[model samples]
Target: MSFYTSLNGLKNAQTDLGVISNNIANAETNGFKKSTVAFSDIIAGSAFTNPKLMLGIGATVEAINQNFAQGPVEQTGAALDLVVNGDGFFTTRSAISGDTLYTRNGAFEVDDNGYILRGGNRLQAFPTDAAGVVSGNTLQSVQVPPTNASGAQFAGVAVGKNGVITASYADGTNVAVGKIALATFLSPGGLRQEGSANWSATGLSGTATYGEPDSGFYGGILSGALERSNVDLSEEMVGLITAQRNFQANAKAIDTATQISQTIINLRT
Candidate 1:
């Protein structure tokens, strides 16, 4: 039992170290969130003449939850780059699986075909009327029309505070393409991580509700900027140190258990 107990502690410490290491590694990743390791204890105790004599068996990992706190806003100055100034996620769809994904990585660009993409996912948006008002609940792909025969290119793209995407042509023509849509969840922290800095909705997170930025519960958009990773280097370093000490202590306990077992064998001899 002592050996098993110490072994579980060793495993727990290793898991903690892994989580901390990952946070440290992704400190520079855009829109990345950190996760913390959780644990629960098991008991070997049974109802006996003296219940106080019972012992705890070992510890086991309970969950690894992500910290969804907003990351620092960084000024990138790129026309396509964006950051959420308030509280929502940029909606995207995976080209491969066609699954709807949510992300905070607003670094986007229009492809050759004029379709906006991020991480190979088509950026989703809502159609806006000539008055720049969102017209319907239907989500459409954000598009920037190609240059015409006169070679009048899309000179610039602007995402307003309210999430309207307007493409300005070189000929001084402004066209309202599509409005970037933001999605809010009942519990943002409950979103399940889908790789590439994306997240998937879960039962805990509930279905995402889409709306224009700064309207209703969705967050406003900040153009020419991006959100940095929320991981804190100093905190992760401290956690690394703590997990190391725990591992060492568990190793010591295992060694002591071995020594005690040897002593008992010697006495029998």
Candidate 2:
């Protein structure tokens, strides 16, 4: 029982170490957020031989949560490179499939198809009219049409802090295309975790509320910049060492318990 308890501790420590390693590895990944492992104590049995609790079971992983804290903003000199000055995510549609996913990383490129995509996902820009007016006022969903190469330089491309997009001609002519929209949830932490540093809305998160960046409740947009990863290398290293020590200590305990069991068995032999 003692050996099993120690084994549980080792498992939990290993899991925590894995999470720390991932944070360190993604330290350079743009818009990456570090995750922390939470542990819960497990009880083996009630205290019978003594007044104090025996406390046999060690620990188990409770959850790994995303830290939504903002990262550093860096300029890349690319017009399409975008950084949120406050809070919000960039929505993108999958190239292969039309599924949408949201992210804070704004490192984007104009693909051969003329659709803006970040990290291989085609960015969804809301459609505007000839006058370049945003179709929906934060109440509308954005759709990206197939690129027309002969199309006159994205006539309606306006980007607002609170989800406002203003499109114009390449020759410095301004037009009111559409307003960019932001989504806020009742409980952001309640959102479901999808790998690749993405999140999916859940019941706990409630429905997303749309707004324009920096206009109302949404954050403003900063062109030619990107949000850096929030992972702190020094902090992650410290966590790694602590988890290692815990793992070693638990392993030693298991070894000691094994020796004790062996001695007891030898008495009969």
Candidate 3:
């Protein structure tokens, strides 16, 4: 029974190590959130010898929660690169499917369709007039391969502080298209993790409120910039060492218990 408990401890420790390693590996991933493994004490059966004291089975990994602290803001020379300074995400729409999604990573680029997409996903923006202003809380549908302009070229489209999108024409004329929308969740931690650094809203996440970046408490949009991952190397290293030591101690306990059991077997022989 003691050996089984020790084995559980070893398994839990290894799981923790894996989490830390993943965090370190993604230290350079933009908008990556670090995760911490939490453990809970596993209690076995109560001991008849003492009613007040119950035997502990061991500890097991309980949950792996993301640390959503803000990462360092980086400046990229691309006009599409944006970093959210506070709590919000850039709303995007699927190109082929037309489904809506949101992301914190502002690293954006114009695709073949002349629409903004990040990480191979089309970014949906409300269609704007030549002036780049949005009309109301509702978003207007904007299709890529923008045909409203004279030359059908993606030129001089800029996102402003009020979520306004202004595009310049080939003749050096400016037009207002539409604004980029930002979404904020009631509980960000409750969001479900989707691969490719995207998150889907869940029941626990609550409904997401959409607005423009740099509007109504939302942080201003920073063009030509990306946000770095927030994983702290020093802190992770410390946690790594602690987990290692704990594993070693658990191994020692198992070995000691084995030796005692061996001694009894030898005496009987």
Residue-level lDDT of model 2, residues 16-91, one tens digit each, is 9999999999898887888899888876554465538465467889988878888998988776678878767666
Candidate 1's C-alpha lDDT? 0.88
Best by TM-score: 1
For residues 229-248, could you state the per-residue lDDT of candidate 1 as single tens digits?
99989999999999999999
Candidate lDDT values, in order = 0.88, 0.71, 0.77
By lDDT rank, best first, the candidates go 1, 3, 2
Mark the regions of model 3 whose C-alpha exceeds 4 Å error after superposition: 45-51, 96-100, 136-154
Q: Over the stretch 1-269, how does candidate 3's per-residue lDDT look in tens digits?
A: 89999999899889989999999998898888889998999875644657457778898888888878889988777777878778787776666676666777888777666666786676655666555555566664433445444765545566666656566656666676667777888888887877566787889989788877776777777777788889999999999999898899889999999999999999999
Q: In model 2, which range of ten residues has the least summed lDDT? A: 140-149
All candidates' TM-scores? 0.94, 0.83, 0.88
Segments in model 2 whose C-alpha atoms lie over 4 Å from true places: 44-56, 125-134, 137-163, 192-196
RMSD to the hidden true structure, all candidates? 1.9, 3.7, 2.6
